[model samples]
Target: MKREMIEDALIQPTILLVEPDDKVRPSLMDNLHSWGYTLIVALSETDAMQRVQGKGEPFDLLLMNQVGHSVAELVAIGRDICQHAGLPPSIPVVVMAECYGDDLEGQDVQMGDYEYVAYLEDGQQLKELLYLLCPVP
Candidate 1:
């Protein structure tokens, strides 16, 4: 098999991405896929809760690209989803923000900011952080 194909075949980490931006969501989704991550996209709060309530596999991470909510709000929403899903406690909740760096890397931050500008700034950075948290290997 081709190297790229073989790489794509690997099981990547699955994350629930809450992005309310109508214009930006698609781009973000495409980037996440290209970065070797599987994403469950939720365009709104209700939509996100519905997905969490569904009979589907629990996501490894909860990432929010806030348009209105604060970091605390993101964490609260993540907590709600975990409880509503009736799954394990403490699903890592990360709010993608303007300020971030290598310190947040490789850590499953629950209810905190992720250096989204840095990680999302580079696909390799995002991949590294997610892989460290989920560890497909």
Candidate 2:
């Protein structure tokens, strides 16, 4: 019998983690790996975009920490990258921040939006969010 090829995405979910905080990056990296995700880490948004623009493995989800850019900006960047990569423009984006500005306070999630900001308190919180977004096959 002939065997069909399997895509990496079908085997394992790939996550593109864009976190600029030196202190926070390590833990996120560890947790993603422990969760059995194929991760590509970028310390900055530009770097993250560059990786997406290249011929590297396509990312399943974008777990980004709002550094210098706003949450909406990052989502747009993800979409733009997806367009360039010839993929569907429906990338799921999770924005992690210790806290949002006054305007965004008390809002944990934006219902029906493709991208939402969440408080990154601990790995457990992240894991729960990941479960909803990325399901390993």
lDDT of each: 0.68, 0.73
Worst 10 residues of 1 by lDDT: 110-119
Mind giving the per-residue lDDT tens digits that candidate 1 earns over 54-118?
A: 65657877777755766566667777876787766656666665455677544434333422322
lDDT of 2: 0.73
Tell me the tens digit of each residue's lDDT in model 2 across 1-137.
22334553356788988888899889879889888788988877678767767566688888888777766776676666666655665677887765556665544574335676776555677787787887776
Per model, how many backbone clashes are there?
A: 1, 0
Overlapping backbone residue pairs in candidate 1 total 1
Instruction: Looking at model 2, report the run of 10 residues with the lowest lDDT sum.
Output: 1-10
TM-score of each: 0.69, 0.78
Q: So what's the TM-score on candidate 1?
A: 0.69
